[model samples]
Target: MSNLNKLDFTTLEVSGRNYLKWVQDVKLYFTAKSLKATIEELIDNEPANEAKKATAMIFIQRHIYDAPQTEYLPEEDPRTFWLALADHFNHQKDIHLLEARHDWQRLCFQDFKSLNEYNSEVCRI
Candidate 1:
């Protein structure tokens, strides 16, 4: 196995808009290091809950932003904290989908400088 201390895992801050991508990145990071079980045990506070909680809290804090960081207390169950984020982001995803659909419906080629620009705009949306 690889040395956990030396690995430079990707730092992904959950900014409400990128939760899905963030979660996937984190999972891949841990799995690559064979540390998924270790992380779960730490989050669960198995043998050294307090110390583990402190370590887990720091890790969680580093990967989250603003409201979510404050909303889910570090003292609470880490699973619960993760679940809350998932729920919040899932709802936001639906709203974003609706907005994207609306934006696509209203998009027009006339709004761009040229056909190339128009194609780029379409790709962006």
Candidate 2:
């Protein structure tokens, strides 16, 4: 269906702030399209597999920001591009974890005027 072909989510940005969510979205999309194999493994010389790989690569490149597009322009295989993106952005998780720990450490019981506000902050952090 035409609706199924339309992209309905945000693209991955250069900042890597949305890397985790982006990866999840990409996986789900690829799975729905039956193209997950293009990123999950090396493709053989079969024409169908080659077409799927091209589709997957185009989808990924179209969903990424300009900086990453230029940087990964030379990459031809979707699997390699996927792994390169993971290698580049996986550190975002550690950075986010450290920031969350810092916020949790700085949280004070008496800082909020209401119990609900304090609880909300705790959930957010």
Candidate 3:
């Protein structure tokens, strides 16, 4: 069933119109500060390990570039909405270009098998 085919636009179900709004708002928020500050904020509120900060940050970037693609990430994926916005911070506060750059980088990678391998390698458990 198509999401739009549903009657109610509310109830944690983000409307397509509202989804665009959220994306726009996110872009605005990220650009209000420097990328470094954005990164710091994401790291500040989220789980982190000493050596995994950069990769975690990258994961955040990919998730935000396309929310649909990242929606299914498990709790331990290290990627989150806030992190993606942080990567968009810039002087002029224009997030489109920065988001595009992140999108480009994200698209370059090949898909992986599963999260278990990621957990074994990254978390060393």
Q: For all the candidates, what are their Cα RMSDs to the real structure?
A: 6.2, 3.4, 19.1
> Which lDDT tens digits does candidate 2 get at residues 5-121?
566589898999999999999999998999888888535753336788899999998789899989988999998999999999999999999999999999998999999999999
Per-residue error for 5 in candidate 3, Å, reads 32
- Stretches of candidate 1 above 4 Å error? 1-15, 35-57, 74-76
Q: Give me the runs in candidate 2 sitting further than 4 Å from their true place.
A: 1-6, 42-48
Number of the predicted model whose TM-score against the real structure is largest:
2
True lDDT of residue 11, candidate 3: 18
**Ten residues in sequence with the least summed lDDT for candidate 1:** 4-13
lDDT of 1 by residue, 1-125 (tens): 45543424444455566666677776676567443543454555544345544555466566666567777665365555666677777676687789889989999878888999888877877
Worst lDDT window (10 residues) for model 3?
A: 7-16
Ranking by lDDT: 2, 1, 3
Clashing pairs in 1: none
RMSD of 1: 6.2
Query: How close to the true structure is residue 26 of candidate 1, measured as C-alpha lDDT?
Result: 62
If scored against the real structure, what TM-score would every candidate get? Answer: 0.61, 0.84, 0.23
User: How close to the true structure is residue 32 of candidate 2, measured as C-alpha lDDT?
Assistant: 98
